[model samples]
Structure formats: structure tokens, C-alpha cells
Target: MSDTIAFPYPDYLLGEHQFRGDDVRAFFAPGGLFAEGPIPAKEIYDELNASFNGRGGSRIELIREAYDSVTFAAAYGAYISASTKPDDVVILVGHSIGGEKALLASKATLSAEIDLLATIDPVSRITTGFRKPLQDVSVPESVGYFFNRWQQNYPWPVDYGSDGRIAVQDTASTFDDQLKQNDIRNAAGGTKKRGCTAPDYLKGFCKAFSGTTTTTRTDHGKLSHDDWIEQQLRNIIGEKLEARPTIETNYGRSVTEDDAADQVFRWDVRNHVFSWGEQDTPSSVELQVYREGERIPELSGEVSPSGSVDFNQYGLGEYVFSITAHAFNSVTIKQKVIVQDDDSSGPTITLTGPASRRIADSAPLTFRWDATDESSVREVSITATGRHGERLSPGTWASGGAPVSGSFSFDAQPPGNYVLSRSAVDDDRDWDGSGSIDDSSVTSSRSTSFTIYDDDTAKPTIAFFTSDGSPLLDDSHTESHGIANSVSWSVTDDSGIASVDATIYQDDVVIRSVQVGANDRISLDEFGPGDFRVELRAVDADSDGWVGDASERISSVRLTVTNAAPDVFAGGMYLIDEGDLLNLKAVGDDVDPGDADSLRFDWDLGGDGRFDDAQGARPVITWNDLVAHEIDDNGDFVIRVRATDRLGASSTSQATLTVLNSAPALVSIDATPVADENDTVTATGIYEDESPADTHVVTVFWGDGQKSA
Candidate 1:
């Protein structure tokens, strides 16, 4: 184990150094938010430190956190610069956003190499509108190995429908190509409350034991506190183990020791031979054999130069053999061999039922076979290979006697090509004339193959792929309106895709539908003032001729459809006298019958093409403010009103507003007493008026409302 650790932010820093009252209260007071919770950064640092503290290495622990990308890089670089010492084993671990920040810190420290990097759902609340999901956190090329583990929170809703931590791909190098292991599991307390368990065999020099350390809980934050995960990390740093020698046991089944560690190996033969090898095996080695958990050795001795041991003298029971070599340090190769008292020769078996034929997965399949042996058939094994892949029959071994026939019923497999094979073994083997069965003369029959097929169960996937064959994101823009838009779709299935049906919906109502086979483009030309939902449904074409229906699968995308323009009509021409108020109204019509109330009306009083004002359904225009540029013309003002639908579709209508001039009205009057006028005396007066015709008329008015002209 090496000493040195890094974390983001030390809450203890505020309490111990800053002496903040709130921080002290939260750390020491009771009934606070972190009273029993809140595993502070310092605590994590201390816990990791205890694992490698006295192990003898230069100790260094650094912790900090910054939200700004620039500051984050600077802080991370400072930490890496501090760890410039040679032979430094850097173990980086973080939780939540800190996990992502930790990885970023490693990425920023390009010159540093990481021995182990682990993360628990690397996530962060995007404040800068720039973020990488957990899935986007690629393992640094310089990191020796990475372990990414995340437990889905309750409700298990992925962020943006993406659980970035499920698997890491699209990195500088393939995740499979890197020395890393990615594991994701649902937290206990969700649909399936299963606890997290580490693999039995560790990777590199780490040994991860399989055990339960915590009960099922919905708190996703507890993953960082998971004792199992922490213990694995501790083991990786503190309890590193050297690689062990490989051992295998072959008895009709080639079973490797790694595959069946500490498992009982059932042996029915009278003799057993063990072969072993090591990287630097000495000329001679000691082998010890014991019976089930016994310290006293049942047998211990040195074998010849060859590393083979026979156990024909042993009786039926459980036995453990330990082989030790000087090359390995304190690592003993142990094998638990369980010998059963069933030494027999294998019998000959033949399949009598399920002749080569096509069947549906829902249908029941019956397998019949005959087994014959001179001594008596003991067991029969049935196996199968299918189009989906090869599969072993559930409980393939069955008990039977010589010249016996039996049948087993099973559900049909998914659609694919398949081959079924069977073999049998007899109850007795060839005896060595010493009242013992000869292990070298075991009886077994050659396996025979038969063809059987089941209907395809996979449904075709419908993808709205681009020209390069990538799926289209939702609400993608299209320029075609009332014209064909390029729409490409493809359906995939394990079996061949039969037919695909594409449909367009306007506001959930089906508008157009067509059939497209295999890979083909269907033109979508639905035009209206509503949203569009394009759906593609597909079904698999099973060539097995199975009599069962394959359900259709569907994928769809929604988009906004541009609205068309509405038709506007203004009332016919109207004449109004000067100073007389005139009102003009315009009505509009739309192809979308439902958008009548949402239509907007605009009026252009000058008929200059640019709408002056927008109003409700009806817009009123008064001729009082009307100015006639051409008085010699018709004195007609072309008032235009435009109507637009909700989707920006518009139309305009024009009407003439004729203004008529009234008779001249007296604006002013002036009279001069040129001569004294009384009843017929000469009098003169001048009157001013506003009218198209310029003229002067004189009239004299007497007292008492009487006028003379």
C-alpha cells in the first residue's frame, strides 16, 4: 500500500482553521443536518490513509473543490504538481460530482500516471451549461486501470434518458481495450432489491471478495459509503496479492479450477490423475492431501519428477489437495475433489422425437430418446445449439437404465437454426479383475446431432436514421412544407425484417400511412397548422414458417408543422364626406378550421404593403385621419387588412376608402362701412371659407336675426 490521497473540499478546514461558528456547530452539535450523516472529505481521507498509513511510503493528502472550469483545472494542476515525486502510486476516488471532478483532475494532470481510479456515479449540476455525463468520463490513457460503479437511484430515471455510468465508450480508446472494469446495478429497494457484490476473482493485483455489507436502501448517496466498495478499494491498495497458478479438472467436462473455486469436484471413476505447473517450479515438490477441513493430512509425500498423482486407493468422500511451490509466496493451490461411487461405462443413446421441424416459442416441445448399455444406462445428457446461440438443456442429465426410453417436455426456443444432441453413460465400467472398476476403460457413447428450429422472437427495431445511418434526435427541423421531405427509416431483427409501416399524425390524429420494405425512404408531405408525429412500426419475417404472430415494434418523433396563410376580405368601397367618421372592417378565413379564434388581423391604412397595426379578429379603420396624396385622383384610400394564422400563415385584402369634400363653410366675415346703409342703402361684406373651390361671396345681415343678400 502507498500513502497519498486527494479529495474535493475539506469541511473540517472551516471548523478547525477558519473557526466558523456554523461549521463548528455542524461538526460537534447534535440534531444537526450532519449529526449522524455527512461523511466529510476529511473522514474519507483519514479512512483511506489508515489503509496505507504505516505501510511505508511518502504520505500526502490533498483536497479541494472549485466549480469554475478554469479554477478547477488550476487547483487540480497544483495538486498534481505537488505529487511529482517518483514511485508515487496515485489512487483517485470520488463520489457524485466530486467523482467527475476527480477524473477531470486526473485529466488535467496529464503528466501524472494513475494506478487506480474509481468513481461512484460521476455527476454534477451544470452551472456553466457545460457538463459531461458519467458515461462521458473516459479513462485517462495513462491510468493503469479504472473501476466505475454506480447504483441507480429510486425511480431509476436516467438524466435526459441517459445513465452515463452504465458503460463508458467512445473514449480515446475503447473501454474494452483499456485495463478497466465498468459495473452498474440498481440500488436495493427498487423493483429488484438486490445487493451489490464484487466479483470473486480480482483484476490486476486486487482481490475483491463477494459478500454483503449493507442492506437494501434507496439512498443513492449511500453508494459512496458502501462498505463493500470501500473495502474493495482498501484491498486494492493494502492487500495486493500475486498471481496464482492455474489448475484444471477434466472428467468428461473440462472444468477449470478458477471457474469452480472451493467447489466439490464429483469423481465416480476409481482412479484420478492431477497435473500441475508453475512459472518457476523446482525439480521436486511436496503434495499433501486432506479430507474435508482436517488439519491432519490424510496423505502427504513427494511425487516423482512428474507432477502427476493418482488417487485410485482413496474411497468415496470429499478430499482437498494442496500443492505448494517455492516460486509462489504463501499461496497454496487447493482443489476439493468429491468422489462418488458410481463407476460405469457410458451407454449409447438415440433421439426418437422432435424430428427436424419448425416450431413456435410459445409451443411445447417434447424430446424422446432411447438409451442402451450392456451393464445398464445410468444417465443421459441432452444439449442444443440455436440461431440465437448454443444452449445447454436445463438439467441435461437424467437417470435411466439400460434399454430404457424416456421423454422430456420443454418450451420451444426463440426463432433460429438449432441442433440437438444426446449422449448416455452406462452404470458399470470394465473391471480390472481385482473387484475394482478400471478408470482407463470408462464407457460413454458418441453424441448424435439432430436439427430443430423455433420461431424468431425478436421484433424489428424502427429507427429514423440519417443518411449516415444514425438515429435522428427528437423535433429535428425540416424545410419542406406541402412538399416531400426526406424521411429514412430502417427496421432490424435477428431474423430478417419483413415489412415496415410508416404513419404521420397531426395532433395525435392519423393523417398519412404507407408501407416500406426493408431499407427505403418514404416521402412525408403532410401540411397543416399543427404538430406532427411520425411513427414507424416494423415486424420480423420469420422464415421458420412457425404459426405465431410477431408483435410490431414502433419508434416515433414529433415536430412542429408550419401553418398556412389565411384569406382576408375587406368590405367593398365606401364614400364618406369630409369630417365624417367612417369605419372599415375586414374578415379572414383559414384552411385550419380549428384556428379561427387564434387568427390575428392587421391593417395597413395607407395600403403601403406594411401593416400599421395588429388587432383581434375585426380591426376598425377611421377615414378621419386619412390624408389624400392625389386629390385629382379618386380621393380613394386603399385600406389593406392582413390576417395571419397561429403558425405565421398570412393573407391580405384591400378596400377603397373614398373621401368627398362638402360645400364651403363660412370661416370668417369682415364688413366695412363704406356708406351708411339703411334698408336699401349700399352695403359690402367679405366671407372666408375652406373648400376645394376658392371663391368670395358678400352678404349683409341686419339686426334681429334678419339677413339680406
Candidate 2:
């Protein structure tokens, strides 16, 4: 049964082909959005073959909406080749939005020499800004906005005092736009009044198996698109007669403006091996591909120290591509088959049941993935400040397995560090990938710590920083502001020391403090604000501790910080004037500019009350009130000279004046009565308000009557 060939575009797509039938092969499928819908066959279940909708807008417009979501399912997976392309094993199952539009139409018509995709739940959903599910803190604010680096720190059941916890808000709900073809028509639950037999079997498999096979997702939880494609095509030819998918995923390493042929994704990995197909017998001791923790760096395959593994690629979202055989020599046989796509409802961990609240800018570390698993995950990582600081991104999700409802998300982290459990593993590496450390289900791989500085940031030296009352200032100014400015900053890190938290942004608003030290000086005077900014946030206090929070660097803050700005600018500005000089500058430059003894001139018109204090520029503008107050006989006047130096560093210098109100006077209009023969008397004008009387630019020397203007 091999006779289809229509593949074109970037060159022979949809699992290309070189058949001979390792176990019945043939690939290619198109028509996910329309091309008539349904040539989407499958030699396997790792169903991936979409072609468009990288996101929603921009990013090349979601890769041109994943290039129209999958250009007829990638022209039926590149003309449905598949007579035998590497043990066949063709996959396409579709769930959430046609399983993420079949690998975005096999990356726009398959050709990377695919093996297994089998997606289930992916969520490139235009951009997944929010499509309903919270009803409370917007469901962890849209699942911590696409899996916030592995649930930040897990342990979230949420209750931060009600109406709280739900960050990641740029805002945008109502199912957030196009959303991967409306979540593959809602993971294929098929409704819209009925008619959705998986979209009429995807329009009868896009007009009777257009090519042969190619699919990104399939179904199970909420899948529809009426699937049965020939007993799932004998389970992709019986797992391609055992197994043998190599590798190739690629995502976070950057998919470039969301290209990779437009993304639909399922591409998660973890062992991904297979056996039979003619030799190399191993029989699946491990081969997972859950996918969804933000899609683990677009996983590829082939790792040593083990058996075989692969992951091709799928970028849009929602995933579950699986094939587990579980331990052979150790005797452990486990088989879990689940392929979905689009809705992207995997990785979740709860426990927010009760705990200190108040989370404004960042906190809600939300949790409760009773077990949510739809697939299309892309990024989740965890913690990992690795090097020796190892924790290698822990947290986790998929617990025991069940719940389901969109990946929720998280944040809080840093505080002291304790968090454990959660679970996602096989993150795929790089930043975290979260794949090992043995999860046996996490009874307590090391959870809950974040007490001190979970992650604020401030350290270079002085892990033992002190500040109970010595920041300086007997009147000297190194550390004196109300007596409670405690600052014991000790942030050690053997493997688990966690925090020292602190922030005193006077007028800024960085406000924080797990312990201000010296018996917690009221938590560092409630995070100070009257001319005191310590911010020595330490971390490594002990949280089963680790902090690859890398973004700002290290678990969170590796800013050994030299915020020590005492090389100069000592702090001194004092002045008070009420009526004498015209524009006596004083608005804002940064700090210094006001000193003389302290300069306090007060002539409240209510004068001399004993409440009158004096500093030093005393009685200096005496030109009879500097020209009787109207001032400026305009010879230019600008006397301003200040300096509080001695370390107080206030500096100002101004000197330029020529006031001669009575020096250039010569009144002689009465001597102009010499109306001799011509009869025309007029000559009286002398001005100097800073020298200005060009009087139409005139020069008249009455000696011979010469006028030039």
C-alpha cells in the first residue's frame, strides 16, 4: 500500500521515505486546518507533523500562525512517503488542537527524517496568555506563565489570603486568541453541537489518508478528532517492530523567531529508546517523553550510559510522546501510552494549602498539579545553581498522576530555601532539563528552606555582614538611621545554605527581609526607608539548597556586589533661605549643595523669635538691598559660592556682577534747548539693566550731526 507522492516545499517532507517496510511504512499527511483534513496517518503514536502557529502574533506572527498551523497537515506530511523510512514507526495522534497541528505539519511537510513524535497536549495556542482555568488566582496566573522555570520552588497550594497568587500578568484571557486551532478543537472532545468526530475523522483523514501518515497529537483525556486510524495503525507497526528512534529535537537553544517550520510541538525526550526491527535487542528499559514542562529545550535524543533514545522535534506545544519498557535485567515491565496535543495540560504540583501570605510583585509560588498532563510543555527547569552548588533544578510535577487542568505556574523561590518534591525530571539539560536524581516519587528528596534570602541578591564578601547599629554616624554617617538597621548577612553554601534576605530601598520599593539580624531588629526596621539602603541579601542559608536561578545569575543572586559607594560623596546638604537672592538654586542634582555652618536664614517677616537659627551667609548682599531690591542695575549680578567640604562634599561656585546703579549717571536733557537754526532737540537715554539700550542701533555724535543705524 504505497503510492503517494506530493512532497515539495523545503524538499521532500513528512518523514521523507526509503521504504522496504521494516513493519509497514509510509509517511506524509496534510489538511489539519483545511486542505480537506485527514491524510494524517501514522506508523507510530509519537504523532508529530504540524506546520504552523508558532504562537499568536509577531515572532513572525506566531510563525505565520505556525505557517497556517500546518499547511494541510504539511501537505499530508510531505506527500506521504513512508514505504519504509527507518523502521517506519510513523506517528500522529493529535489531541489538543489536533495534537498541536501534527508537528506543525511535520515542520512544514516533514523531512528531518522523523521517527516518533506521538504528541498529545501542546499549547503554542497563539501565545497562551490565558484561556480560563484559574477562577482563583487565575489558576496560578496561567500556570506560572508557561512553567516558570520549573515551578520556582513548588510547595504551593495557594491561599495567600484569598484573591491572591496568580502572577505572570500581561493580561489577555477569553481563551487567548487562535490558540493552536482552538486547542485542536478543544483536545478533540468534539462538541460545537456535535459533528466533531475528531473533526469528522479530520475530514476522513484529509480525504482518505491523503498521503499516508503524519500527526503531532492524538487523544485520550479530552481528545476528539475521531481517531482509530486502523487500530492506531497497529500501534505504529507494533512500535516499529520493537524500537529504534535515534534523536534530534532542538528548541530553547533558540528556534529563531519561532521558525523550525512554524512549531506545533510534542518533542520532549528521556531515554526515547526502542529495540527490535532486526537486531540490537534491548526491549525498553526506559523510554519516556511526557513533554510539557515548557517542552524541555525541544529535546533531541541519543545519550550514552544507557540504551537507545530519540526525540526529533515539534515546538508548538502540548505533548506526551511515550514508549516505556522499564528495566529488563532488573525485571520491571511498565507500559504507558498516551498521545495528546494542543491544550498543554501537564506538570503540576500543589501544597499551597497554607502558609505565610502577601505576594505582590513576585510571590505566589503556586502549586497543585494533582497530576495535570496534556503535553506541549516548553520550559520548566526548576532551580539548579550547579557547579558544586548542585540542586540542579529540582521542584517537580506530574505527581503520581491524575488531576489535569493546564500547567499553572510558579515563582516565590529564594526566601530561605527548603522546597522539595514537585517533579518533572528529564528536562533535557542545558539550563536544567530536570531529568534525573531518582524521583521514586519524592517523599523528601530535600524540600522546604527559603527562610532567609531564598533569592534577593547581595554578596561579594562578608557572608557574616553585620549592621545591628554601626552603619556609622555618631554624626559621621556610615550607618546610623534610627537604631534598628540590623544586617547580619551570612550566606554560606556547601550544598544547602539558603538565604539572608534584605532590601531597604528607601524611596525605591525593594522592601524585603527574612532576618535583619541582631535578634531581627524589627525585620531591619521593616525594611528601612529613611536614608538607609543596605540590601546585602545573602543566600545559601540551607534549603536542601541550590540556586541556578541563572537569570540574574546563580540560584538567584551572585552579585558579590561592591555597592560600597564611600570612595567619596560623604552626604551633606543643609540650607534655608527666604528672601534675598532671586534664583538661589536647589531642586535636585543627586545629593550635595547646601552648607556654611548649615545655612539657616529665616526672615519670616515675623522675625527674631528665639526660634531663629543662623548658619553663615549672613548679611552679604548689601548694595542697599542690592539696588533697592529691583536689583540688577544690569552690570550683571551673580554671587553664589557654597562649600560644605570636609567630607560632607557640597560644592557650588558662582561670581559675576557689575552693579553700578549710581556710577554711570549723566542727566543733561535741559542743555538741549539750543534750538539754533535747524530746530530738532532730543538726546536723553542711559540704561544698564545688564547693558541693553541699542535703541534701534543708533550712533549720534552731535558734534557734526552724524547718525547711523
Candidate 1, run of 10 with poorest lDDT: 23-32
Off by over 4 Å in 2: 1-23, 26-66, 77-90, 93-99, 103-117, 125-709
Across 1-709, the per-residue lDDT of candidate 2 in tens digits comes to: 1111211111112333333233433333222323231232343212211111121121100111232443545554554342224433444433323334444544443343434333332222233211121222221111111211001111111221222112323334211111122122211122122223453355342232345443333222222232322223223434444443322222222122113234342223332322212123334433234444332333322223233334323222234322222211111111222222223233543444226533221344444333322332223333323223445333433333422323333342444333434444222221112343221211212233232233434232333233543322222233332334454443344433344445554444455544443123323444432444445444333222234432211212111111111111212132212222332322212122222224333211112232122123333443334444334344454344343422333444343444443323333333375787887786766533232321234345666776644
lDDT of 2: 0.31
Q: lDDT by residue for model 1 over 401-520, one digit each (tens)? A: 322576655453444566655666555643232233233334454443433444455677766754345566777653324333455776788777777888888778998898877677
Compute the lDDT of residue 357 as modeled in candidate 2: 38
Candidate 1 local lDDT, residue 331: 29
* Candidate maximizing lDDT: 1
List TM-scores for all candidates, in order: 0.33, 0.16
